[model samples]
Target: MSAESLERRTRNYLNNNVPQIQDHGGHFEVEDVDEETGEVTVAIGGACSGCGIAPMTMNAIKHRLPDEVSDISKVTVRQANGPRAAVMPNKTDEMEAMEEYQDYNPPF
Candidate 1:
């Protein structure tokens, strides 16, 4: 396939998958894809910044992306906020609650 098509495919996949990731208070983005090197860089943000499960999530992305987007020999996951930020040291209960509330849904 052409490089242009490969890039498009990668972008489309990211667009579709990012929302699912965001639902967990984490953000995912496609940073770059090098056609020649076959390296794709992805950025993770929000609650996923420094979370321990980041590796698992990244690994899943790396595996899934290549399956969908051809020519991607490698996937690099970048953290927007450092690992420590994932813990949000200074975040208070009310602040955390508010953030959660904004994304909450009523079970009923």
Candidate 2:
């Protein structure tokens, strides 16, 4: 397929899959897609940044992008972490939440 065709397919796939991430309380926005390299660079915003589910998004967004466009070979995700951003509720809250999630009393 042509480069233009590849770009369109990749863009469409990205746009389609991003909304589904809402189930995980996260979202992805595709910033730019390189047809030649099959590299997609996207920004993770909203509930995704500091959420407990952020890490999983790495695979969901980065790994699957290439599936959309056959020519896409790589995906680069860039995150924007800011003090006052909505993604960050607060440092103390974030740390506490992570710790709590880590501490588990497993069933024998």
Clashes of each: 1, 2
Tens-digit lDDT track of model 1 for 30-53 = 678687878888887777775555
* Stretches of model 1 off by over 4 angstroms after superposition: 1-5, 82-84, 87-108
TM-score of 1: 0.62
Q: The CA-based lDDT of model 2 is what?
A: 0.61
Q: Any idea what lDDT model 1 has?
A: 0.67
Minimum summed lDDT over a 10-residue window in model 1 is located at 99-108
Tens digit of per-residue lDDT, candidate 2, span 1-108: 666676677667756656545655656666676666666677776666766545555556676766655777888876655563465443433543676745532111
Kindly give the stretch of ten consecutive residues in candidate 2 with the minimal lDDT sum. Answer: 99-108
TM per candidate comes to: 0.62, 0.58
